[model samples]
Target: MNVLSRLWTIAAERRNELVSGVSRKTNAVEAVEDLAAQLKDVDAAVVLIFASPHFDKDKLADALTQNFGATPVIGCTTAGEITPLGYETGTLTGVAFPRLHFRFSSRLITNLSRFSIDDGLRFCREFVSDFGETPGWNSLAILLTDGMCRQEEALLSAMEPGLAPIPILGGSAGDGLDFKQTFVLHEGKFHSDAALLTLLATNFRFTELRFDHFLPTEQRMVVTDADPGRRLVREINAEPAAVEYARAVGCSVDELSPFVFATRPTLVRVGGKYHVRAIQKVEPDDGLSFLCAIDEGLVMTVGQAQDIVAHLDREFTGLKAKHGQPTLVLGFDCMLRRLESELLKKYNAVSELLRQNRVIGFSTYGEQYHGMHVNQTFVGVAFFDPENEEETGGEREK
Candidate 1:
């Protein structure tokens, strides 16, 4: 018999009251424990938790160990966690999908120290191969990795061969406050220095994923120097980098060019659509440095802005049209885009347009989905009954 997956989420922030006179760390752990206990009473095979920056990982781990220790609990820190009802900020909130039944399982890769790029790739392929081989089950992979752990790209890279086309969906967990270091919570506990994998076998069908980022801005430059692994740009067109950028954007070399990138940046047309490669860095001498590589002679285009309200509304609406209303949404937003979204909120129209898609996801240093590179965007998946078209107005977290 095919079973349905029901989900719910709970969150808490360190508002001095939750912690009272206790340590900020203590309050976070307490919030997690309380949330965990609440989730335990439900019949969910999946338990995910996104804690706050002020949380105590050790205590949070103990709390998860105390209750609902068997369910597949996987999550990380978040800029904000989206619940079925509304958005939560500065506190820890969780989306718990329980009660409904679905085949689910979890595994943790604790030995990241031992996780080599080659080996990790092999593991991903193997994982996909094993999952793909499941009989008659439409399977998808939900992966969460330590954002601080430098191996995320390498890990995704390795898994590419195996998961190249499966459309893996997940986000890098972040602590609510900073881009410093974030982790994943598994089995009601916190996991840092580790990665969590959840392979879901569902009765629903997988959809085709087609995504492309912004177009490149004018400025032909080469990546004369680069630190690809670190996401740092070194040089452009064999110049100081900043100079070339200053010329392109007509901006005086300044510290804010990096910040200006969010609004007017270059795009690389990969297949047909434009995608952002990186931003130009303004130097003290009117020179520029780019955040992404600019190999010598690289042709670029200034990406045009496209209003997301209409696009996003249709995206979410179309899903509703096809699957009725989605029971859940799992968003993996790029940290850069989240910053841009803050700007979008200044206007009522933009705010409503953006919020129309209240996707619950943590801002990530980077995001992963079905095996491709994405930046400054929101990526997610919706769970709906293929045959059922009833609107779930009561459902909140996705």
Candidate 2:
């Protein structure tokens, strides 16, 4: 569909109080202007943007500052965007929260390599203190970090304690599978080795959502050797990581690739639940690079893919039945999930579900659920009717 048609479709679906739009214009200035025009009617407290990495960062930043002028904009480059029309590429998609029902505050963390647990805890404490709290308002946080920084595990660990009781859901900024550089945009500019944490308070009823289409198998492997800091496994079951993994999945060493990894993911059990430890790439030395944390002696099982369409249908249906239809679902989806859907020939079905459910955000290298940085999963916040807040058990505390 054309850009205007897509915008009109979004307009028709949006709640008058919440604003969202997508722009296919390739020019950086035009893209921002298009978004600005769509959001013009809403007196937004903050605007969140998810953009294609192909845009020039400096130009995009300048245009955003000029167009939005002191409106507190925050966003990041995306692997791909989830638009009003569902999955899209080379597009700029955004959601503007009106000031009447929503209030926002943000902080930017730079130099992630030197960020310690203590630092993160302190930073989060200060942020929450400054944001304060309201008697009848519900609060949540959204984190956007450099996808390539490899620091999400540490950062989330530290901040969890300080921000306890305030739910968090987020995505790692992606560069279209480039793996070289990823950036987080805050305060009108993009920065590497950085993260943006935004605290939001709203009167609307909201709930956190998480789901993945994978089940663990009995077959397992041990990481006998690894570079824990870099999330690289050199040996699995005392054999070259890539070779052993390929054999386990019934594929030759030469056939090991991102697609293979996506189709056959590795899982680790934590707190009596399984979480995906997705493989990002096969290294030159036959090592396996993971998207989340990994360490020597960790036991990982080969995860089998389930029915993607049915799983999503069931989840969304349950959500609507329980909480009524969500006005908007701010989603953080893993890019690997998108790839696996294509591999399984379920891309269109998945996109249709996202569109029907009112999901808008970006595909990420990794996704954050509360304190955990997970992969091959969908994490989101579903906002429901403010008018029904009392019936929905007003103002969720956690």
Candidate 3:
């Protein structure tokens, strides 16, 4: 495969001044400086930065605002970053939208645990008020929420109905698998226990992307008992959740670990398509906790794996054919998919696909697409140029 792995490491500055870059510099200031240098010429309206959780976010936020200067900046900590250089840790990746291309506005939702459907409606109203009169242009919302908050489904469900036809895509923030804390940047500061929403009105042609390679098996489990607030399922078909799940997957109860849960995720059908509702972990009482919301009476099927590479190859090829070769794809891939890919020994193949497709993003704690907060799926925005078919700037590493 002709994979240009380190493409994001080389600052890409097109004639239109749309730039995206990744830096592995450990020093917060140095990393921000390097990213800022690539975007210096453009009047940046939106600067999305994803960084390692180890860096002091306060200091990093300071460095970013100092360089970008009050531009509507938003991003979050990540488990692992996806750059043009493939999967990486302890690095910062960013994309800057030049003023000519995008207009940015933001709203921060505080106390997500207390957030409700009403809050979603309110946020939508505020968004409309702030970015009034977005006509003849496409608008997309970028959401960065605390991955540990456990309220993604509710939040997205609430806000989505009101913001009709404006597609939303995002990832939950992570703390490098620690799961202790996560932060989102808004108005040049990092906030925990909150979600940052940014609305972008852009002139660029782009397509929303999401795909998974799991087929539903006949084995089904009904959620007989669950705590929707905590996303814990205590019973499946009136049996202990873990035990029943293991039985369905053809494994012993003792084998129910994070790795096993990741590999043997369950799926729920929505609109005739199966979406993964991945198991997060096994609880002390033998309950199973899920990455997204779970409720009683939900029918979930034991998902069987297919060729991950084959599925992705088709999705990417079809996207390129429909969109005529993307300039880039800002991807939000579910972490469980990464685990499943690694377990299936297809991690490198998946990475090469991402590199070849010019995907720059991170493995999310969860993925948001439209109204659904799904798991084990890859969601992204594929950017296309209406003016030219020639490939734009970005150093190619063979």
- The number of the candidate with the highest lDDT is 2
**Please, what are the lDDT tens digits per residue for candidate 1 over residues 1-398?**
22322222222111100110111224755676666654544556566666565666776667666655665656777666554333445555555554232456666778664578777767777776665544444666777887666566556666656566545777666665455767777765566778887776654433423333344544544555555555544466666666555556666555354346666666655566555654534445434344333444566565544554555566667666665654455667666555555666633443353345444455665567655544555667765543432321222112
Off by over 4 Å in 1: 1-26, 37-41, 85-87, 110-115, 129-135, 175-177, 187-189, 205-220, 255-259, 278-300, 308-311, 347-358, 386-398
Q: How much lDDT does candidate 1 score?
A: 0.55
Q: Local distance difference test, per candidate?
A: 0.55, 0.90, 0.83
Better of 1 and 2 by lDDT: 2
TM-scores of the candidates are: 0.76, 0.94, 0.91
> Candidate 2 lDDT, tens digit per residue, 58-128?
99999999999978889999999999889888998999897767889999999997879998999999899
Tell me the alpha-carbon RMSD of every candidate.
Answer: 7.6, 4.4, 5.8
What ranges in model 2 sit over 4 Å off?
Answer: 1-16, 388-394
| Model with the higher TM-score, candidate 1 or 3 | 3
Best candidate, TM-score: 2
Task: Per model, state how many residue pairs clash.
Answer: 50, 0, 1
Clashing pairs in 3: 5-84
- What is the TM-score (0 to 1) of candidate 1? 0.76
Better of 2 and 3 by TM-score: 2
Candidate 1, residue 45: Cα displacement in angstroms equals 1.2
